[model samples]
Target chain A: MFEHLSIQLIMGQLLIGLINGSFYAMLSLGLAIIFGLMNVVNFAHGAQYMLGAFAAWFLLTTFGVSYWGALVIAPIMVAIFGLIMERLILRPIQHLDHLYSLLATYAAVLIIEGLMRQQFGSSGMPYAPPLRGGVNLGFMFLPWYRLWVVLFSLLVCIGTWMLIERTKLGAYLRAATEKPDIVEAFGINVPRMISLTYAFGVGLAGLSGVLAAPIYQVSPSMGSNLMIVIFAVVVIGGMGSIVGAVLTGYLIGVVEGLTKVFYPEAANLVIFVIMIIVLVLRPNGLTSGRGTST
Target chain B: MNSDANAAPLLQVKDLRAWYNESQALHGMNFDVRPGELVTLIGRNGAGKSTTLRSIMGIVRKRTGSICYEDEELIGKRTFQIARKGIAYCPEERAIFSLLNVGENLTLPPVLRQGGVPDSELLKQFPNLRERRKSRGTLLSGGEQQMLAIARILRTGSQFLLLDEPSEGLAPVVVKEIGQLILRLKAQGYTILLVEQNLQFARLVADRHIVIEHGAVVDTLSAEELVSDMGRVKNYLGV
Candidate 1:
């Protein structure tokens, strides 16, 4: 296997792996955050990501907003959308079983995807790459936009980690995750915190979509296509562990990429296989204690 | 203390009724706590002593009737709104955040008023907590968790405190320490409503004891009266 593979091929696949890993990390991180605090599976996350791409495209074409502007505006728009969804739909059903939220969000996925398909059609739309140039690093050519995605996502991940793990507000969030009523009794306005948290998580999904628009096609099915893989990533990482979600996402992406190079047939199957193995071996997940204990 | 006796009640509960879903927990409960007073709600397990505190804090949402704090009705207010009006609750379970370290748990509650006990003073008071500041909530012993629960609320600057079962599962020495801490808080003029199954512990720190049986106050006894009627009090506790 090694003898037939050139250094250039391996490097190219590695870069692709890193880019995919960045997406996995961002999507799974959002999922973990939402699940951790709100106890909602957020099935519509992929739709929100699609919405981000469409939002960016809409901004660019309809209003002449540059990619730079859309990059910031799109996620905010998705967050506002998420805020409304949480307040109107999720909040009322919050006290019900976990299944209710799952169904509700799944309904949202159908509705959002249906609306997008009706408007944009099933075909992929091309979004021009913000940075067209590539850099040669001796082994392979690296697209500037792809490099930007990896670095920018990594920065966002680090910043989120710091915010959740290091700050006083984060302490409130962690406490609320465990006991929202007690947190409320302490005058922290836990309901408002919960609403904002869900919005923030979906905002990450939107940001991921914007980053992916230049790389992958912006289509109605784009988010749903990635949703299953992202779910597999969340399961492999553990349901609510922030660190587990992020690290496992990147790890799975790279593993899948490597499989594509060595054995293309197993590329798609690798993540599910890993998920089964992880579930059997470490049922509580790799980073259990760092997340909500309940 | 005599002057505080004449001061208007800091909290007044009148015909307060609460339910856990379909089952009622508090039945026409009534009590009052004066400024600078340390009161204890003494009852058996499942006697709704804790629920009374929770009802006052608005944790039990199915509650009705009146919970007046500083003469303002609290029955309709949300928990956070009630909390904002200078009342703090330390739940029976301690409810510490396992993900947060000792230091974070110590300062988790927000200060609702101007006179919150400073973090420096609280750390000094609970020196053990200071030493294990970086350790997670699960790392603490039962007594330390209880201490952390009580200490955290002190920083809220809420003159009124509701503590549930602080000495429930602790060793004799730790229970004495908690009693001393309660006395210290009382000395500093912080009004507290404590729930205790330990009749002995109640006698140690409380100025008055409100006996709850079947979710209603059956008797009110001062410290001097409680000491004289030890046999009846122990009988009520079934200990």
Candidate 2:
């Protein structure tokens, strides 16, 4: 299966896989968190991601904020916006069916895309790389920024794990996910937790956008397109555990990468194909988690 | 109503009505829970017992009445916000996060003990939780899960807990354990609102029973008064 592929071709596919893996991991992590804890699948997650990238572009091009500044500000601003959406919009519809929630977020995606189109022309905006050079890894040359994204994403995923699994607040977040009513009965501010969970999920999507801006064009259509692939990732990973999302993202990224080395034609189709197989074999996902499962 | 009782009622519901879209579920339900009072809402299915709990916690849709906790208006608050206002709700489903282990389930909510409830104290109070600390919530026996559910709320330090059907699916021995736990919470100065179908259990544990049928309060009576009128329980609950 691997005979005809050159070592260079193999490395090329693997590196791209890693880069794609970073986004899939981050985006799916956010989706899983929001869905698991707050019981909202956050269809607008990708749009939020695009919004982050565009915010960075707008900040740098129009406001003169540095790429570094936008990296922090864009995610924060979008996160605050998520908080507002939760308070002003999502909270009211919480009692409706899960389908209503899914529709509500889909509407949010449309609203965000419309606003972005009005502000930035329909044409995609280019993002210049913040840090300039690539490091030669004996097998292939790796861009400094691409490597930063992987490492930073790993740190973020781990940090989030620690916060939820080890910290006191994480405990609360998990508790809220399990039984918000029960947790609230304890006199704790569970609504605040819901708002923050949404913010954190949206913020992760924003962070992924900042990382992708230089690599991909900042466009209104970015999130919707990537969302489909990420949803596939969520399905295969089961959207239950944070680790499952991140790990399966990278694993599938590599699987797709390996396929490209041997047969480039199959690379794009592999994720969806795998998603179908997984759904058939284990519809509940790789993790046996219950509650708001994607 | 006594001296040194200046603090507001722990929970107060006035003409609180709730609906699921167009259908009304709770009709002008009026009730109050004094500090340290163990309150139970007892009624047959479709009697607005669960709806009253959901409406008070802001988990139900289309609520149109007053829900005040410590004199603060709770009508507009979200379920989580109402929870933040010092309330915890355990649904009738026992919706414990199934995948999370017993310890994880207990630890998930913010267990801040900043002049609030503490987890260690709860573990101390419910030794069953500590004993089965490593078990998954779903894997635990029904009684154990119920105990863990109660323990989870206690861990958060919320003195007021809205527990729905803690005894509904448990074994007889487990039901007895639940009754004991309710008394334990009452003894510890915690106020509880329970929706119980186990009349025997309710009679053993409840401080007061507020009976409802078709969304309106039909009766309020003491535990001793209830045993004497098993006829009423048979009429209202058909048990």
Candidate 3:
């Protein structure tokens, strides 16, 4: 059974895993940041991501905007929506228990997805790849757009990690996450920082959506399926660790892909299974005490 | 309200009332601090010494009454806005960011005004912090953490410092070091509002001592008066 597996088959599954890992990294990173700072489990993250893909589609269909232009405009549009959501919805109930915030975001998910479904039906819509064609390697063929997604998302994750870890703004963010009142006492406007942080987190999710638009179908439920997987990734990595989220995302993605090759039935269950195991062993996740989350 | 040309109070609190949800912490609290004056708030554990400072800084949200600093009312202002008005607070608990190193913690607070103390002078002032600049905030000893907590705010360029129990949970020698640091800051023309349970430490540095009992100021004594009347101080503090 082991000898029958060809090089092409192995390489293909690995590439698929890498593609899934890119999305996982991007989505989980956003979730980690939002959760770390605001202590709000942003269940609307998936909906916001779907909106990103839809925004790209709408821009292309209505305004004749290219994919490149959508890449720039879509995330900004979604981020503005995120700001509005924070101000109108999240801020009002921020003082309540953590459970309320989770519920509110979950409601937001329903509303956003429902609205999108009403506008565009449940059927999937196609998006043309920004970079067409594939490269023929010795073992397997690789699509340029898939490669772009992997590389671009990798750069994004690294860049975001650097911004949060090495910069002055990052220092304020980290401190604010730990103690918002103390941060405010230091002459910094902490409430405004919370709003901006929520926006930035959602903006990253929107960016991931735009990147996924060309590969996956542009549909209302696009993010819902992936959201659970990303959440599992976040838990396995650690609740709020940036490096853990990034690394665990790719690692799990490859593992899931490997499961598909070895045991097709376990591919979908692998992430959750890993999540449960991590919870039992290390309740704070793999990279504990690295971020604001307990 | 005195209208003397040179004796205007930098901080003035009148009839301040604060509550932690339903439990009242402060009731009709009143006090005043003039520029360059180190006013010590001395009281027993439940007498609202910390609450008075917190209300002044807008940390206690359910607070009412006037907290005028430099003639500007700080009653309705947010914590950061009050901070921007040249007032810095160091809480009794010494809330240092555990994840941040000493160097990072030192630079955390944004300098409000133009002429705040620079990093070099701050590090020079707290030599212990300079030695442990690269160490995590929680890794420091109790004395070093206290020093870092106080030193971090010096760079904010704030005119008034609200220090709450800086001498708490420190050894005698470390307490003396902190007292010396306070005197040095005063000599450099920094106005301080100190909250201390240690009456001896209060007597050493304060120009005036405000005695609080059951959330209200019962007496205001000069440093000379505090020295003259140890019995009254002991009665109010219950030490």
lDDT of 1 by residue, B11-83 (tens): 9999999999999999999989999899999988999999999999999999888999999999889999999
lDDT agreement of model 3 with the native: 0.90
Ranking by lDDT: 1, 3, 2
Q: Which residue pairs in candidate 1 have backbone atoms (N, alpha carbon, C) closer than 3 angstroms, thus clashing?
A: none
| TM-scores for the candidates | 0.98, 0.84, 0.97
Distance from true position, residue A142, model 1, in Å? 0.6
Q: What is the C-alpha RMSD of each candidate to the true structure, in Å?
A: 1.4, 3.9, 2.0
Top-lDDT structure, candidate number: 1
Off by over 4 Å in 3: B1-6
Off by over 4 Å in 2: A1-4, A38-43, A62-64, A84-126, A188-191, A218-225, A288-294, B1-16, B28-40, B64-91, B107-117, B155-163, B191-194, B206-208, B232-236
Which residue pairs of candidate 3 clash?
Answer: none
Higher-ranked by lDDT: 2 or 3: 3
Alpha carbon lDDT at A102, candidate 3: 92
Question: Ten-residue segment with the worst summed lDDT in candidate 2 chain B?
Answer: B1-10
Q: Which of the predicted structures, 1 or 3, would earn the higher lDDT when compared with the native?
A: 1
User: Could you give candidate 2's per-residue lDDT for residues B141-177 as a string of tens digits?
Assistant: 7787887777776655566788899998778888887
